[model samples]
Target chain A: MVHAEASTFAEGLSKKQVYEQVLGQAQALFDGQRNWVCNLANASSLLYHAYHSLPSPSNAVNWAGFYVLDPKNPKQLILGPFHGQVACQTIAIGRGVCGTAVEKKTTQLVEDVERFPGHIACDGASKSEVVVPIFQDGRVVAIIDVDCAELSGFTVEDQVALEHVAELIAKSCDF
Target chain B: MVHAEASTFAEGLSKKQVYEQVLGQAQALFDGQRNWVCNLANASSLLYHAYHSLPSPSNAVNWAGFYVLDPKNPKQLILGPFHGQVACQTIAIGRGVCGTAVEKKTTQLVEDVERFPGHIACDGASKSEVVVPIFQDGRVVAIIDVDCAELSGFTVEDQVALEHVAELIAKSCDF
Candidate 1:
């Protein structure tokens, strides 16, 4: 799975440049790929590479990553490739909004950090957050996420983007 | 499933503005509720209201949607709910780049229409396109789609928006 695909992603790209690259690549890949999971993985890897190392590039998000569903266990979405200081490899289906998304079978966009039940503090600094569900057979299977150090960092533009992507998943995912 | 949830939304918002309102509602519901399927379903309904009968709005995308994975079938992205039409219900995973995205598990930025294989002509005039994947368990389960009637209709900003939602699905999915 570790291919030399992202090599041209600019080892020399600055943090700001990296973020711009991530953003650019995000648009490019999405327009080019039109597939949600692949784009999700790509976006997660790009952001992870930029942010996972903390004191990361200026543009990298503080904490960002994805937890995918196991084909063997559709009940939970295990943390897959991401960008941030570290990763949360395990999350149950009904535990938090992220997990509850599966149980609830819907996208959960949390604007306030303090109110969520079972919220994991992987990054205590993350204030506002958003989670969109990936569905199959009218069922919740996985979730996509973005966390920011700033409270209410998630925006209208951001919601539209995420929701649009979620919309795509709902349509094309026949797996 | 068809509750009068967005009746208010329908009253105040223009057809084009409906997408934005739905996105806003979707974001709030994400943070506040656990009805994952309902959340997405509602979002789809808003989009359907916004552009379904309109003449593909000007200055913005006319319609947008996604596909989901079906446990029983891995070869196609079963169209779930969308903002435009219902005919795009079943698209083979390998027929078009959208399908190939499932095949490659990679994002595709297509600037031209005739280039992709099995490209379902949701909007035959659509020139440029973007496909982002929704993943669960390191495997692609769906795709996010944004189509414009104009060729090369997408930009970096659009990509950012689409990917954000895509990530939301990846993170908020039941997984």
Candidate 2:
């Protein structure tokens, strides 16, 4: 939870302003918290709340969470902490957007899940998605996945800010 | 997640209409899902999305989720599926608002958390809260907890509709 004392984005704030506040809250919420689960839990919560407070297009966010690489199967991803509906439990490294992010070691910002070939429909309400791979020791460790209810719900600003959050989580947690 | 094909609330609908729609969605979302975890996951998602579409005061909601009775410790309530920040992991029965609801076996609708004595500060940002006990076999199995960012955020109508939701969840899930 973002501390009650943490700064809040004023109504009608720009995306950059919101992400900036989110980054501050993310650092404050995650710093020194070494448990990956706790870190992801709070980080996802911070993003979910921050964007939900923003304008119409941004506030349509329906899902925000993570998918961590399975230790038993390095090439597969398993469900992690999340803030929305029951999700698909597992995805192969190259099967879905999350897996594709892990396989490519890059961010996947899908403007429309329906248009993205081989898209995995975990929550049927999600229309767009952004998945950012978290890295540790020069390899992908997990991916931060955010889904919005509107098509093209995410933008470049969200991608950049979330990538920063993923980096922070990768470094702070003892994954 | 509410299925993309699920009927949606039309623009500018009345509060009563919205809740009725929400109730219908809740039933449809939970109908065939028997797993307790999966049921709570989708139930909360349904509420979160249903309210997020409402107007200002109604849209002030920040947290929606559950606290189930821990089998090993019937005197405590353990956090279950939730949307919002990381929450308080446990609340002793007869203690906090959640506990008070369990002890009293009634719905709790607090207009302001600040005025509620011994209110547990799970999320400092939460100003108002509502908790409804889910009963099974004549005992409380869980409580549906909703928190809002605005003081006096919940209403009698909300209490009624959410209580209905709790009843549905209690009946549908295999606790």
Top candidate, metric TM-score: 2
lDDT by residue (tens digit), candidate 2, B53-159: 78876688888878888765788876666666656556899987999999999999999898888898877888999999999999999999999989988899999
Tens digits of per-residue lDDT for model 1, A1-175: 1122341354554444544555555555455344444455445555544443334222334545456675556665665433333334456788766777677766666776778988877556667677777666766655767777666655564555565555554554333
Give all TM-scores, in the order shown. Answer: 0.41, 0.66
The candidate that achieves the highest lDDT relative to the unseen native structure: 2
All models: lDDT? 0.55, 0.78
Q: TM-score (chain A) of candidate 2?
A: 0.93
State which docking tier applies to candidate 1: incorrect
Winner by DockQ: 2
Cα miss at A132, model 1 (Å)?
Answer: 30
Tens digit of per-residue lDDT, candidate 1, span B66-147: 6677444677665543433212435677777578777888777777767776676755556777777877788886787756
Candidate 2, CAPRI quality class derived from DockQ = incorrect
lDDT for each residue of candidate 2 in A10-86, tens digit (9 for 90 to 100): 78778888888878777776654465655565666667777788887789997788888866578788666677655
Tell me, per candidate, how large a share of the native contacts it keeps: 0.00, 0.18
